[model samples]
Target: MRKAGWNPIWKWLAIIAMIFLLAPLAIALLNGPGGSSGLYPSPNAYETISNASRSITRLPFDYDTSDDVEMLKEYVESNREALSEIDKALTQQSRVPLDYTVPLDELLNASGTVRLPMRLLIVQARVAELEENPGAAADVYAKMSVLSPKLATGGLLVHVMIASAYETMALEKLIELTPRLSAVEKKRVLSVLTTNARKPIDFDLVRERESDYCKHEHGTVRGSILLWSGSALVDQQVDRAIETDDELLRLRDEAIDLLGS
Candidate 1:
């Protein structure tokens, strides 16, 4: 459903007054929602990616002391069990949308499973493998990234997964995929990038990416971010800095252009 708004002229004027005002939206509906490389794998692909990553030749016997490999193993095995069911849920075997299809709760049925620390490192190793060999990685991380969001314990894992997706070209094809991410998830992604990743991508870039991908779609993750970015300070200043109310209006109009239903 689209959000109600004033007619274009009024909307544009407000936007001009506060260009950053629309930054809260999560989706733009125009040209967003793809990762770039065009590789949108199906649910089956995801299973294949996750499974193949753990070839008999490259298995992590155990993680650090902070991790419990037994629990991790149980979780992985549980997820694998869901794979057969997930394969049936696919609208397309090669590119099934997995935003909600993968059952995190069902996958976590084991009392012996480790929640994240252990899986995070395992996910990282899989991502590295994806970076080196996409075909194998495709059989490994591409689908794994899609599913990781469901399994992600917090922002750190999400950030690592997103980064790994990009570094590995696993998600190079789709643009607007925050299904695994939340507003909080995005903030975390930004924080981690700002603090750790050698090349940090800021929140603004993330917003821009959503805006770019969505191209003005209503109710999408990108639109939600813009509508609720809550950047009053920045938005207010942007509103006042305009040389003229008319220019302000133009800027507002541009932002509003993104506020479609």
Candidate 2:
């Protein structure tokens, strides 16, 4: 009689164990694989950017004084070929292409590398401004403004945030330089800002890519359990990020309008 009672208990324990084991599997299966099947942008610009990122030397000081400008000029001359390639790439397309299938580490590495060129551009703009060529400075800022949007497109949240930062930096520089720019240069800069403001970053796509990244990271059973359990919180955080991006873009547009006026 004791053995019979023990058998039911063992069976119940087995059922509970199975439920624990299979629940994550079931959740993962139901969610299906994340990632998009849509066509991505051409990799040419991204390839160029990656190549350019390799040749850059980190600048230690801000591009403020004549000495700083000279340092920037030296950096620019040293990375001239790479910077040229980046400029050519920028003219070709308005979006930075990334292989979403790459590992998280690779994407993070890319995030770090891509910012070098933006820094280089800022240096170049400052050099021009200090040289008393406000038109050239405005041109560099315009390119920075345009490239900022491109970097955010078809990227993860980190990329979007980086782009947003660059955009703000470029806008501030342009605003400071606007009074010095010729009427034609001001109009051109205003036009670029207007166009970029109109095409806001697509947070929907960013959310999807983020989910895909999580799926990629948590493919194992143990990982899946953690992911499945924490997905609600992850999604909530992502939504909050999206809202933040929306507000930032709105303010950016308002700033652009002020630039135009």
Candidate 3:
């Protein structure tokens, strides 16, 4: 069964009941759930992060007014349900298993001989959002069954896309990371994750993650793990990046700058 609190609505319902059960209680709810509680991550942090995500997507050239936008709108909007699930999973969490037929990695790598340029546009939106939104990144990260390697492929753009996603992690997580990850990667993850850790982190969850995950160590150990574990994923990414040519690389770099700023 889905955990009871997985429904964020449950909290709202509690507030509404207070309106009738006790008028004074209703006024307290109006102050906001986490206003005095301090459980909420800052509203401004989210605003800044979302701003970074949008900046990455802003383009110098006009976006094609084509069917691809419609398709992309459909794809990401479709993920809205999943995004809500992400919110729940990150905060309250749940035990109920979702019935997913296809894997996210499979979906991420899903491409055919005839991919339209519009598809790349769609991918950039999803990827950028996933990179900037740690909760969403958690959802995807949960679904990543295993790791491979990074340095194998000579492509730089793939490296940056992967790097951008890592940047969203909160601070302490970044500091705890291993050395295999380049300084570029470590900072990126820290930048994303730092603000969220100002208060506290669920150490229990951190403990459950493999010690070798870049988030665990300080230097050499972390780098080795990332360099080794990320090989296959990196190869896939770098190869695809190289295929996109210089223009896509330019866009990807611009997007990264926006994500960080």
Write down the lDDT of every candidate, Cα atoms only: 0.35, 0.70, 0.32
Best candidate according to TM-score: 2
Point out where model 3 deviates above 4 Å: 1-67, 92-195, 198-261
Residue range 1-261, candidate 2, lDDT tens digits: 344355778999999999999987787787645645355556556566768878887664655444566777787788788779778767555344556567778878777656888888878887787778987887788777777767666677787777777777776677677777777877877776666444656677776676666766767454556567887987786777677667656656654665577
**Candidate 2 positional error at 246, Å:** 3.2
- Model 1 earns a TM-score of 0.23
Global Cα lDDT for candidate 3? 0.32
Residue 52 of candidate 2: its Cα lDDT? 82
Residue-wise C-alpha lDDT for candidate 1, range 188-230, written one tens digit per residue: 3333222321222233433443333333334355444654575
Off by over 4 Å in 1: 1-47, 51-62, 66-261
Q: Where does candidate 2 have its weakest 10-residue lDDT segment?
A: 91-100
Reference-based TM-score, model 2: 0.77
Better of 1 and 2 by lDDT: 2
